[model samples]
Target: MEVVRIGIIGLGNMGSAHAKYLIENKVKGAVLAAVCDARTERLEWAAREFGNGVARFAGIEEMYASGTIDGVIICTPHYGHPAEAVAAFKHGLHVLTEKPAGVYTKQVREMNEAAAAAGKVFGIMYNQRTQPLYKKLRDLIRQGELGEIRRINWIITLWYRSQSYYDSGGWRATWAGEGGGVLINQSPHQLDLWQWVTGMMPKRLRAFCAFGKHRDIEVENEVTAYAEYENGATGVFITSACETPGTNRLEVVGDLGRMVIENDKLTFYRLRQSETEFNRTYKGGFGEPEVWKIDIPVEGQRGQHHLITQDWVNGILHGTPLIAPGEEGLKGLTLSNAMLLSAWTDEWAELPLDEDRFYGLLRQKIEASGAAKTTEEKTLDTTGSY
Candidate 1:
């Protein structure tokens, strides 16, 4: 296939975005061939916007069988990610799904299995991974420039949503919709990066999640989670959706140095000697390792979604490595699920989370959701995204 004709399932905010860029010929070696959405209004919008050159289908299977697309980007709701991915793989099509693979890991495991069995290109929209800042941090840790990691803390709460956002119709934060709130929609990338950039996942964690803490939604809008890694490294993650003048900062402490990311700048506090080595040999009680502060250059994150799409297309055409493999998405999703599980049970959640238990509890939340929507709908943020 010289050119890949891509179909986007789910004409919601993110899917329509893919449609616009693909139709604009922004992605090399890829074209917008088809779009699928269960909503008639979205399908009509596609027809009116792209004309008949691009096919429109209400059913994904119909679009897949039409033979117009070589692959699909799943922009469906969180729960639909896995099922659609598995279907796409069964039909011998590459799959690139949006974040948080699924509401729970058990279903995502099935999707990952399908991708492995099909041997197709499976990517996820963890566009943040493309950011130069995160790349540099990962490289520094992996290269041992920071020595052994001892602690990590991230405070990313800048995603401010007006009450009208939840008031918007068909809200995804509801138990019946996304099965959770901020973590599901606004924070998946950070959750992914929490373990990804550090090359470490917490062995266990205890989380305190406040449902409707700042909003009227039923799921968590604020979260404070503490984690413990296997190597005795500790971590803290705090996120919120309604805080004003929010902050985005990350700190990683290592034996040789400390790295801080704030205000789009990376600063490293390098120790002249490893704290471990210094403590092992230093006889002076008041002495400490010398510290040097250096500011590292970093580029802003631009065209993240476009970059990820282009990477996926290139992967299909040239067998290139994917920036965010669909399987690795499970790791981030696991952390989010574990947080929710821990909060629901009022206890610590262990790694390799209990998928069945989380699944069952999520079902209970869905069954228990009885809130009535009383506000009109508003569109998702096209620039910053939902």
Candidate 2:
């Protein structure tokens, strides 16, 4: 009970990274006890890396039944996340899954339900939540410093993947294997943070998703989604392939003022008076509220993947709250799903999405996918990409 023995499922790019971090003793109160991967080559790599001290399994079931690990970190594909986490929960093991939760909300909902029923620590790898700047942004909104939000715009096109990147894996960009493109893979963190920091969910959304716009993939590579919040606030989410030097910028405007986070800097333009009140009372037709541009100080080190793992381990052993609870993952997935649905149906998709319709359409894509295409397996050093 002192040290939580952790097993990593799927020794792919992300799984191997987690394994290396644990092997290096980066996370306190956590030890790398086991690993699982269907690929024999990956299993051989694990054996070579960790030697005989770490147990190797062919799959999740074998690893779970081995009973060597107190927790499992599911880093499998988009589809495998929910099922593997649910199985881990059923076997009474804590789970810390990588982001997006799963391809869709239904399966993720089922996994969350099982985690709740099991009464075990369930966390998602929303590592960005550990960033001090985002934490401060969420706090500012929650504390009503920005007043009622009016608009949210995030231009996050930093996810530039090449054709070879998609070709490297059979499941890379295919709907049946990886679910969707940019929205599901590269944008999960931003999607989660968008709703997380704003403290608001869209009531409806319309999206224009360009499938294979930049890459030769089946899923969307470029997307422009317009969302309407319940409180009349609107949002625009724009993302694309690595066509140019990408940009990551987020701007939130409210009654009191506006806040922007870009280039690791948080700036706030505080209005002397509420914009709404000024508009209502001002006698001048064109005058607006006076504004003060202030740079909000975010002074702290930003924790990434390893810190999230540490927190997950801490949550299990010390009852510390998780940075990203598994249940909250559904919110971001909902937005992704809604955007895809809107693009497919050519209409504004509403909240509490039609799960059945989405599932049916997804199944159709899977069936039509026919044979999976794969290229040379390449694992890049994902340093600042996270």
Candidate 3:
């Protein structure tokens, strides 16, 4: 197909935004051909806003049956992600899922298997990976400019959601609905970028998660996690609600230097020699390796969701490499799931996480969540939040 006809499921805040972008001709080589939502009001909105050119369906199956779209973008809730993607793949359609893959790894694994078997292009909306600063960081590490990584720390607590925000949706912050709180809803991109930029996944992790710590919700709002990589390097991740003025800072320490990203600025502290070699050869007992503080330049605009969507279309039509492959999304989901699992069990969770156990525990939570209580709905302007 020269141009990809894209259908978006779940016409909520994000789904609506995607529709508007496409209708406004924001993404090149892509058109909003179809849309699906169980809610009649949402379908009406789509019809009114997008006009008669866009086909509207009550469910994903009907949308697929219509055969109006060459690809599908799943923007449903946390749980519907995997199921919808698998359905799209079964119909031999390309898919681009939002993030977190799904509520749990077991289901996401099945979805990935289906995508692999279908041989269709599967992409995940890890939009932050398109940021120039993160791309630069990944390049620096991959080029061995930072030498051996020794430590990493990220304080990404800018995801402050009020109780009203949670109350706006029935599935805002529930174990059964949205999976977890901050980690699942707000920090998925950061968690994905953590592994994406570093190119490392923790071998094991211990996390302390506080449920309803800031809001009247059932999932985590505050978390402090410690991770140990296979290379013996350690890292710490701290995230929370709007407890204080949130901070977004990432620091990576290596034997030769350290890189810090904060306030939209990138700084590097380079050592004249590797700390390991200096320590081994220096005669002085108290001297340290000479350090130079240099400002790293990162250029270009951050290609957020729109960029990923365009790339997904490009990948399907022209064999372009996806910025976020659906298969690799499991790594970040594993980290998030491991954190919740560790907090729930009060123990460290190992990598290649116990899928069955996690799924079982999640099922229990779903059963226990009696009925979701929703308040007056409001879609906050999510312009600068990302």
Candidate 4:
């Protein structure tokens, strides 16, 4: 096939945004064949906006059976992501899901397994991975330019949302609806980038989350999470959707030097010698390794959401590799889950999270909040890996 037919489920903010570009011919080899939503008004809106150019469905089952789309983009709420993707895959459709893959790993793992079984192209909307700045950061770390990483700290509270934003939708900030607040929504990109650049998940984590701290919502609105890596490296992730003029700073320290990314520019403090080597060989007690401040040139513009859609389409049609493969979504999602689990249990959550326990706790939260589960089953009975 020369082109891929893509259907978008969920006519919310991000979903509508994707529909616009795909219909506008922004993606070279992909077209928005159809759109789905649970709300009738959204379907009517789509009809009014796109006319006969795009099909509309009020649910996924009909859209899946309609045979109009080769793939589906799951942009519904967090819980709907995995279930809808799994269904799509079972119907022999490729899947590109929005981030935080699912409310929990157990469900996402199931979705991953379904995609694997179907042998279909699986992609996630981790559009941040397309940023050259982050791409360069990953290269430097992977190439050992930064040596063995020692620490990672990101103050990514730039996605500030007001109470009105949360109040706009019933599912906006509810525990039963959107899952978690900033961690599940606004901060998923940063979380994905945090682990993507470092190429490792935290060995264990302890987190403090402030529920309804800023917004009048039940889920966490502010979070401070600390993590320890298996290689003795440590990381701190701080995020919130309640701060104005917030900061987006990422600092990574390694044996060779320090790198900072803020204001879309990357800066590196290159050390003459490895910090460990200097510490080992220094004859002068008070002397330190000489540092050179360099502004690392980050090239290329962000391809953003449409680029990811095009890439996924290319993967389906031309055997191209996915920039944000759906499976890799588990790493950042694990971080988000562990942080929430830590806060909920008031303890350090370990890597390879106890999926059953986390699911049980999450179910408890939904019960306490009186929110119903959106997945097919109430039990955490699925498993897979990155």
Candidate 5:
């Protein structure tokens, strides 16, 4: 019954995808009022595709002054997230920002502070968590069905990108533009899922990354990280964009059983711990460990981005809880930044990540790398393992 007007900032790949979702779904309680992008082509494309009546702006000032929208979807590149979000908040508009809210923790903190000062609903587009498989995992962990988690291993190498993919955009591989390659762009979803399901923070992390594997890039394309949790649980994070054939397998080993999600399928091996308790009394039939194979029926909406947009709209209009708040966005960015810092410094980095230290390191890398901060208006390759 209520209409939530949305203004989309940045018409890049994900921005375009969100725009399409908004148009196609005719999502309840939400309407795309305006679109903003400095690129004339993108503004024209949105006008042509959506309609000429749709207000198009080449600058944030124009969009904010247009008085045609209620909220903003920040779908810009990495570095622009914080500033765009702050501007949106300043305009008295709610915000739903694209993931990895910021490439560095300091920027995320700044964005959070700005949002807090504005008192608007600021959400993050962590659409992967809306998947049935991960939601089920989070529920199981919360229910204590997984008992005490001892270890976790997430091998998220399915995000394989070629040199041609990186070449499609000038900001693709630079520190000043995209910050870091795989960790910043590809692995944020997985990192968020990891921390979400585990409900614990890593005390320390060490990583070894491949910075020279790709043909034309200064940032890393491959990473292998070791994380030690505060609860003494250990986790392994492995990712790469250069592997020829890659796979994504996440296994969480707990005291009661082990939950494994691979290739969109979830399977849980239920360990019969009660039998061991009985064996303690009888002291017999303890020769072998007992377990039962159970395949979890994964229930999830097929279209993630669309569902995320719908939820954000509902949250703004009807007070629905956000699937991922902007604050949680910092954890993934922190982990990604820490991983690179560990690899670059050849030492383990700690969590509740050192904001000043990470930002200092990131600033140094951006200064040392001779690259542009933002990409010019052009067609971007959107077929990035979506």
Candidate 6:
């Protein structure tokens, strides 16, 4: 049981949650040694919450300079992710950063390069991958049980964010601030899952997105994308920050059978062999497909971030495998970029995506966007129709 010292660089909702979990869970041998935040009030709150023994700082440099913390969890805003993680990596500290990796792909790439150069463990918090169902699915696919995935459809319309939600943080939807809407923030998990579960990459993509009804800022609130995989399998990805009583159902159809995860419940419809055997075995109509409904038990809803963090820390200390490496963080970011780029250009964008072209587009967007402020004075309503 090797001990690892932990530090956190943000004290907002998610960051505070991670810190509290570190305190409560006693995650393996990890210790919450320090906390940092730029906001004076938040920094004071974190300092008091962590008590006198825990070091506190107003910025990342101070935290790194304090010399007590080994690894740092970066839970900052969308724009700050790359710089913070890169800094931590440069300081030779293992890093765990919240998703989207960056507001743009280039930022993530820089952080990735920094991590590679520094030879430090860089983990991204796509904790949703910790779900047992996904782990099983990954295993099943690896064993060739899925037999080459043919098509996948992910409907992530449940990410509902309101105008007041956007107003809660002035940086919510601006291209320069949060980068993009649903894709950058809420859908990164699903996008990552899309590529992870399918075990593939898109060769080309065409997307349609809508700014729709949000008066808060400029950026997409709804998106629909069609992607062609390198292996010739196709997928449709639909996401929105606007929808009432929306559905989140991920369905994948492979050569073997079809699996569906709806509202956290996983069900697999395993198809029988031949039509004659199916007709002789089944009691349904002549034209009906032969299928067996299989129910998968649900795993408990513990804190995924804590579990992922523990795994990462243990991996660093004891040579265990990482749940999600920092480099993989760029996949979701790249997917988001492709979708947005496709929508912006109203054309199909080829994959093995051109990072430089996308970076240029992002630079133009950032320069065009004037200073936008963000505040936590209000809570974003995670419910609304686009």
Clashing pairs in 3: none
* Each model's total of backbone clashes: 1, 1, 0, 0, 0, 2
- Which ten contiguous residues of candidate 5 have the minimum total lDDT? 377-386
- Over the stretch 1-386, how does candidate 3's per-residue lDDT look in tens digits? 88899998888878888889999898899999998887788889888898999998886787887879999888877777787788788888999988879878998999999999999999998889989999999999999989989899999999888889888766668875677789988999889988888899999999999999856888899999999998999999999985778999999999989999999988999999999999899997889999999999999878568989988888988998888899988988999999999999999999989999988887777767643521111111111111
- Per-residue accuracy of model 4 over 232-328 as CA lDDT, tens digit each: 9999999988888999999999999999999989999999899999998889879989999999998887748887888888899899899999998
Pick by lDDT: 2 or 5, better one: 2
Which residue pairs show collisions in model 5? none
lDDT of 2 by residue, 263-286 (tens): 999999999999889988999778
State the lDDT of candidate 1 residue by residue for 1-386, as single tens digits: 89999999887789888899898888999999998877788889999999999998877788878899999998876766787788889899999998879878888899899999999999999998988888889989999999999999999999888778887756456886666888888999999988988999999999999898767778899999999999999999999998889999999999998999898788999999999999999999999999999998777665379899999999999999998999998999999999999999999999989999998998888877753321111111111122
The TM-score of candidate 2 is: 0.94
State the lDDT at 51 in candidate 2. 99
Report lDDT (Cα) of residue 286, candidate 5.
44
Looking at model 4, residue 54 earns an lDDT score of: 94
Score candidate 2 by lDDT.
Answer: 0.87
Provide the overall lDDT of each model, using Cα atoms, as 2-decimal numbers: 0.86, 0.87, 0.85, 0.85, 0.81, 0.78
* Model number with the top lDDT: 2
Worst 10 residues of 1 by lDDT: 374-383
Whose TM-score is higher: candidate 3's or candidate 5's?
3
Query: Which parts of model 1 have CA positions greater than 4 angstroms off?
Result: 299-303, 371-386
Predicted candidate 6 versus true structure: per-residue lDDT over 58-104, tens digit per residue: 76787887788889988777777777777777777989888878877
Where is model 3 more than 4 Å wrong at Cα? 372-386
Answer with 4 or 5, whichever has the higher TM-score: 4
Q: What is the TM-score of each candidate against the true structure?
A: 0.94, 0.94, 0.95, 0.94, 0.92, 0.90
Task: List the lowest-lDDT window of 10 residues for candidate 6.
Answer: 377-386
